[model samples]
Structures are given as structure tokens and as C-alpha cells.
Target: MPIDPQAARLLAMLGAARPTDWPGVSAAARRDGFAALMRMAGTPPAVASVSDVRIAGAAGPLPARLYAPRDGTAPGLVYFHGGGLVAGDLDTHDALCRALAAGSDCRVLSVGYRLAPEHPFPAAAEDAVAAAGDALGRAAEFGLDPARVAVGGDSAGGTLATLAAGALRTRVALQLLLCPALDAAPDTESRRLFARGHLLDAAMMARDLADCAPGALDLADPRLSPLRDPDLAGRPPALIHTAEFDPLRDEGALYAERLAAAGVPVRHRCHPGMIHHFYGLTGLVPAARAALADIAAELGARLAMG
Candidate 1:
């Protein structure tokens, strides 16, 4: 099927607005570029009644924004935003986080872990794991049910969410992955089919991997590439979403396959007419809103299960 008209328009808009020289810019410049992208893409930050707090991590403090639902303290999700692990923060994802909180009837903790290039490879990964630990460790303080905690993210954030699920090993109630770039190496059919003009270009992927990895990351390391994990045992249930026109689509689908093969209960969806980062385009994309609703329904059901 052809791409949705909205997706086509979005792609054209993105092409028109893309920076002329992003590949040669400083990390800070790259960060600013993504911030602008978020602004161009959707609604501004919602009134997050949720307070901001810093969690203790191995590398210092990891900042997080807490969004409590209208129902009060409930199950919660630790949501990481996608910016190639080099950009994006809580501010960029605040609207989506608030929507998730309201729709899922769960507290949403928007994690602001350190980005790469400056932090590099395992730094962001480690901080994510630590933040999950910190969240679980202080569940009572946050007024959340420890048994109902889940991990969720989009793109790079989704990859981290999955890694956190695997690392936590039953500590997380569920995993929500939205078009996650699970494999850094581009070897899948989706990577070939949707390599360009889908919001996530192959060149951008290469640039991000190069910046984030530097010399410390082995692309095949299971920590960096969850698809490389030989064992997916003991992980929690997961809901993984994929966009048909995303280079990362197959990796997300394949990871779901691997999870199911390992006996993890999984629900996977491939939106055939959508593109990468569609989940964050809820303001302008109808499919994006539906996707968010699906996630909210799933998370609400799972949270109620406990």
C-alpha cells in the first residue's frame, strides 16, 4: 500500500525544513535541531502537574518528569523519548507523556537520561537502567504501585525501554515500544525498503550510530543492539508498534518475534501507511492518535491486571 497522504505531506514538510548541514554540526547544534523538529511536529508541552525530580544514578543525577493521572497514584511508565540517543529530552516529549498519562490512567515518568556523543555508548543505557532501579526503589515515594510499573519509549527510547525490560528481568510489568531501532546495523529487509524518505534516513542512522558509539560500542553488542541478545528469557510482556515505512520496522517486528519465541507474551502492530516517529505526531496524524489509544488501552489493561 502507498503511504498515507498525511505521511506524504509530513515527509515533504520534513524535507523542506531539514537542515542544510546537520552531519557536520556540533552535538549541541544537533540537539537544537531536534528541539526545533519537535516544535514543528506537534503540540507544545501540556500542563504537567507532575513534578520534576532528579534520580541518583552512577553517572550523577538523571532528571525525570512525573505525570500523575486524573485517577491519582497508579501504575506508571518510564518513558524515554527518541532523538537518536543524541538529542531530545523531557521537554520535547512532554505532551505525549501527558497524553499517555491521561489516556493510560497511569503515572508517566518522562526520563531525561544523558545523551550520547557527550555521554556515549553505555552511558545512556546505564543511566536508563539505573533510573528504572531508582524508580522502582522509590515507588512508594512516587505513590505508584511497584508491581504495575512498565517501561516505554519511541525509537531510540523504545530500544532503551526494551533493554531496561531485559535488564530489569520481571521488575517491569510491561514494555511499550514505538518504532524502536533495535538493531544498529542495517541488515534487515525493512532497512533496505525504507532506507530513505520516511523521516528516518539511512544516512542519519549512520551519523547517529557513529556519534553515539564512537569507539566504545560494538554494534552487535546485545546491550546496544537488543536484536543481538541470544537470550530473551524472563522478560515481561510487550506491545511493540512498527511503521511500514520505517527503516527500524523489521527490527521491531523481529524483536517481537524473538520475544514470543522466548515465551514472552507480545502484541505487535505494523501500521502499513505510517512512517517513523508517527507516534509523536499525534497532533497532526490521525493514525498517531489511534496508535496512542491502542497503547493506552493495553497499558490500562495491564496495569489493572496487577
Candidate 2:
């Protein structure tokens, strides 16, 4: 299919906007812009309940939100938001988290991991691993079934989720990824075709990597790019969703292919006519709403107990 008409309009609106000053914008301002994008998601899908909670992070207490669509034990997910690893927070993804819990009848935990230009690369990665371990070890505290706790995220978060799941091996139930940026150095056709003017700015993406992984000589380190990780066997199953027009699409699909080759169960889907982070643009694109529902169905089927 061609680019979705609705998505095209959204792209137009974005194109008309004032450009951001990259490598100079403060992290706080970047986060504000990131949240503003999510505002277009319209009203978030309602869930049964929401709770503010804390999980042990690599450094200290990590503030988190738990969304439960039903009472009693259910499948759980630790979700990370998309912001290129330098921006985004719990509030930014609240609605999406609600929809996940409501749609899948799961307990969804949205992690507020540290951002870049401040906490930097290793910090977020460590927190992600710690949070997943903490959640898996104490699922009962969040009314979750320990055996079904999954780790997932969007964009940069998809990287975090993969790291956490890979670090813990088969203990994690699943790795649910949405437009994950898995390669620090990428040379894919998608990267060249959709490098800019598609919601995600490639130059800005370069800035994000510099901000988050400053001074890092090796980009292929699995901690920085999970796609480089060699030990895929015995890792939990994965469901990776990539947007057809996203620069990060090919890398994610490549990771899925690699995982399957390594004997890990994986499912990769490239949603046509969608851009990066399209799953969070429900208000701007009606097709995105359907995309979320489709993803939710996959989540429900994998976790079993929708």
C-alpha cells in the first residue's frame, strides 16, 4: 500500500513545523517535544486500574506505573517509551500502556529509566536489566504471573527491552519490540529512503546517539546495540513490529531474522504506510489505532489469557 493518507497528512503537519535545533537542544526541551507528539494520540484507551509504583533500578529507585485491566494475576509487561534514549518518561506513554493492559488484559509496567546527556547509555541499559530482573523476581507484588512477564519498548526502548530479555536469557517470557533502533551503525535501504521528514529525523537520531553514547568508540557492543549480541539461543521468544516507513525498520527485521537463525522463536511484521512510532499516533492516523489493536491481539495470543 502507499503511504496512508492519514499518516501523510500527519507528516505534512510535522513538516510545516519549526525545525528543532539538534545537538544544542536541552534534554528537557527534547522530552517536552517528544511528549507533545504523543498528545496527538487522542484519548488513551481506558484500563481497569492504574497504580504508581517503584522498582529497583541499577542505581536506585526507578519510578514506574502499573496498568492493570483486570484484577488478580495476569500476564505482565515492562514497557519503555520511544525518545531516542535521550527523552521520554512515564507520563508520555501512559495512554499506550493503558491500551496495552486493556487490550491484552495484562499488568503493564511502564519504566521511567534514566535518559541521556545525563545518565547516558550504560545507565539506562543497566536499569532496564535491573527492572526486568526485579519485575520477574517479584511479579506477585504487581499482581503478575511470573511466568508470563514480558519486556518491551518502542524505538530506543526496544533496544532496552531486548537487552533486558537477552541479559536474563529464557527467564523473560517475551521481547515485544516496536520500531526498535537495534544498530548503532546501519546501512540499510530503509535508512536511506526514510532518513528524514517521516516523524523521525535521521540527523537528530545521530545527535541522540552522540548524546546517549558519547565517547563510545565501539558501536557494535551488544549493550549499545542488541542486534550485535551473539548469544541468541535460549533467549525468550520475540515479537518485533516495525513501521514500513521507519529508518529503523530494516535493522529490526534483521534482528528478527538473526534470532530465528539462532534457534529463537521470533515474529517480525512491517506495518505498511506507517512511520516510526506510528503505534502512538492514534489521533493523527486512524490506521494507527488498528495497528495497536493488531499488536495487542499478538500480545494476547502470546501471553495467553486475553
Candidate 3:
């Protein structure tokens, strides 16, 4: 399949303006790099209402953003923002979450989970689990239906979503993963195919793993990498989206296969001519909105089932 022309152009422009060794750079520098990249993309503002509220967690109060659909009701989503678990927060991904809420018509709870190099491995994963539990416990307070809830995210957020679903089990209605960073192990077809030209590079990914699992956790551990998870049998249905030119694409695809093998319902799509960050290009890339519509349809169907 041909890559989306718009995505190709965007990648070319990004490569032309490449920053020096982003992974090895300072944490602040990497964060700034992402901000600059998004600014360049000129993403649409989040149409969903935004709130900076706190939820109770075993650790303490956790910050989160609630994106209510205009027509509000059941089928709420708990979203984790992508940033390799080292950067990005509710604010950084506000626009994407807003678009998701408006586009999918599902209330979105953007979890502001703790990051790494400061918090590290199980920290972000733990925060995500606690936040999901907190949301479910207070579903009525958020005007959401307790029976219809989905968990999702991109990149590192994708890992959190998968972990959250597995950790919460029957509590979630479905799982949505976009170019998930399911495995940090450097051996995958996507890595070989799009290692350089794709918006996300292997070097930066390596850096993310360093920062995210700096503590006593193993990067190859299935608990951290859904691809390696021994059993995905009872997990909720899933809608997994991958990009042709993404390094993490194979991991997502493999996870989908694993889920299916475990009898978990799964729908996986590999968008051609698209890159790792294409999911967030809802404004710039037509394929992005198309993908979102597919996701919205899936969410609607899941809500109907519940």
C-alpha cells in the first residue's frame, strides 16, 4: 500500500528540520522537541471541554482531564497521552483528546499519569491502573455509565492503555491502541522498515526505554510489553491501529495476533503511507480523520453492546 501523500510530505519536512540526537538530549530538550513538532503540525484545538481535576489514588491525588461528548452519556473513554512515559501530559495532548471526544462522541478522561527519569517503570503503569479504578468508582459522578467504559492511548500511552485493560480486566468495555509501544525490544520488522524516515526514530525510542525503565524493571517483561504478555484471554475487545511507516507497528500487530490467539476479539488496521504520529494528524491528514471515524464507529458499537 502506498503511504498517504500528506504524511509523506510531513515526514519529509520533519526530517529536513531534524534535531540533533533527540534521545540523548536533555529531558527538557526532548519535551520541547515534541512541542515544536506539534506546533509545526498545527493540530486542531480540542473541541471537548477541558478540566484540570484531581482523583484519589493509593499514592495520592492524580490530575486528569475530562472530555465530555456534546451529547454526553455512556461509553466514556479513559485516554493516556503518548510520550514514551517520559514526557507529555493532559495539556500536551489536549488537542488530540478534544478531537477524540468530539470525533468519537465519547467522554474522554485523559489521565495525567506520572512520567519517568523521575518516576520510572511501574510508576506510570501503576498510576494508570489507579486512575482507571478511580474513574470507575466515580463513574456516576462524571455523568458516565459504569457499564460502558473504554481505555486507550498512543505510543507510551498505548502501553498504559493495554496495561490498564489487563489490570482492570472486566472493568473496561474495550481497548483502543494507536501505534502502541508495546515492546521496547529492538528487533521487529517495523523497526527495520521505517527506522530512519518515520517521524519517530529508533534512537529516540531507545532513549525513552532508558528513561522509562531506569529502575528494577525489565523492559522485555510481558507486564510492561503487552506483546510479551503470556495470556490476553479475558481482555476486552480491541481496536488496534498501526501505521505502515512506524517502528512500533509490528508490536501492535503482534499484540493483536496474540489477543486473537487468546480468543479476545480484535480489529487491527495498518494504514499505508502513514507514519507513527499520523494518528494525531486528524487535521492535516485525511486518513487520520478516517481512522478516527472508524474508531468512533467501534466505540459506538461497543456502547450499543453494553
Candidate 4:
């Protein structure tokens, strides 16, 4: 299927201003640039309330933002933003968090994990585990039931969410992944099919993998690539969302298959004619909005199961 019309237009617009040499720019500049672009694409949807707080991290206090619905004491979701583990922060994903909180009627805690090249591999993963633990540990203070908490994110953040889920196991009710880059090895057919023209190209992904795992760290390590984990039997139920036109599409599908094979409940959906990062484009694309609503419904249902 061809890309959705609105999505195609977005791709064209992004291509027109896309950076030619990402490695040449400083990480801070790239972070700022990405945030500005997201802001220009659409205005954030309003929520009942948003507050900033710090959570205990492996390295230090991790800055986080909380989005609460109008009602009191709802389920909680620990969210991480996507930027290949190199860019993105709490501000970059503020709008998406607000939308999720409003749509799912759940409190969302968006964690600002340490980035790569500076903190390197396992640093972000460690911070993710710590933040999730903290969220569950302090669920009452956040007006959430500890047993109803879930962890989720998009792209690289999705990878982190999976790692956190594996580490926390049944403690987390569900795992929500959107266009997740689960495998460090890009040998899948989708990687070749959508390698260049799509918003996420092969070259950029390679750079991101290298930055996150500098030196001789094995890319196949389960901490670095959750799909490589030897055991997925005890992991939480999963709702995996993938894009038909995304390079990581096959891997996300494969991960779902693995989970199901390991006896874990899995709900996987591949959005036709969609590309990576479409979940955040809810304001500009009709498909994205629909997808967001579907995700919210699923999250709400699964969390309510307890």
C-alpha cells in the first residue's frame, strides 16, 4: 500500500527540511531542532493537568512530567519519548502524553532518560528500570493503583519499554510498543524496502545504534535488543503497534510472534500505508488520530482487567 495522503504530505514537508548530515551537528542542536519541528507540526491537545517532577534514576534524579486526567485515581502509564536514544526529552513528547492521558483516562509519567553518546548503552535502560520501579513504588502518591500500571513508548523509547517490561515481568500489567526498533541487526526485508525514503533511514538508524552501544558491546545482548532475550515466557501481555512502511516493521511483528509463542498474550497491529512515528502525528493525520484512540481504548481495557 502507498503511504496515506496526509502522511505523504508530511513526509514531503519533512524531507524538504531534513538534515543532510546528522552526525555533523551537536546532539543538543539536534534535540532542539526536533522539538521545534514537532511543535510546528501541530499544537498539543489540552489535558486536565500536567506537572513536572523528578524520579530516582540509576545515575541521578531523572526529570519527568506527569499528565493527569480530570478524574481522580486512574491507571498509570510510564512513557518514554523516541529519538534513537540520542535526542528527545520530556518536552518533545508532552503533547502525545497529554493525548494519551485524556484518551485513556490514565495518568502518564513521561521519563527523561539519559541519552546515548554521553551516557551510552545500559544507561538509558537502567534509568528506565529505575523510573518504572519508582512509578510503581509510589503509585499511591500519583493517584494510581500499583497493580494497574503499564509501561510504553514509541521507537527507541519503545525498545526501552520492552526492556523495562522484561525486567519487571508481572509487576507491569501491559507493554505498549509503537514502531519499536527491537533488533539491533537490520537484516529484515522491511529494513531494505523502507530503508531510504521513509522518515527513518538506514544510515540514521545505524548511527543511532552505534551511539547507544559504543565500543565492543554486543548488539544482540538482550538489554540492548529485547527481541534477543532467551526467555519471553514470563513477560507481561503486549500490545505491539507497527507501521507497514517502517523499516522496523518486521522486527515488531517478529517480537509479537515470539511473545505469543512463549505463551504471552499479544495484540499486534500493523497500520497500513503508515510510516514510523505516526503515533505522534495525531493532529495532522486522520489515521494517526484513529490509531491513538485505538491505543487508548486498548490500554484502558487492559488496565481495567485487574
List runs of model 1 lying over 4 Å from the truth.
20-22, 44-48
TM-score of each: 0.95, 0.97, 0.93, 0.96
CA lDDT, every model vs. true structure: 0.84, 0.88, 0.80, 0.87
Which model is ahead, 2 or 4, in terms of lDDT?
A: 2
Clashes of each: 0, 0, 2, 0
**Quality of model 3 by C-alpha lDDT:** 0.80
Off by over 4 Å in 3: 40-48
Worst 10 residues of 3 by lDDT: 39-48
Winner of 1 and 4 under lDDT: 4
Scored by lDDT, model 4 comes in at 0.87
Best lDDT goes to which candidate? 2
Estimate, for each residue in 189-277, the C-alpha lDDT of model 2 and write its tens digit. 99999887888888889888998988846998898878888777888899999999999989999999999999989999999999998
lDDT for each residue of candidate 4 in 190-228, tens digit (9 for 90 to 100): 999988879998877877777888788888998778899
lDDT (tens digit, per residue) of candidate 1 on 255-284: 999999999999999987888887778777
The CA root-mean-square deviation of candidate 4, after full C-alpha superposition on the true structure, stands at 1.3
Ranking by lDDT: 2, 4, 1, 3
Query: Which segments of candidate 2 are over 4 A away from where they belong?
Result: 18-20
The candidate maximizing TM-score is 2
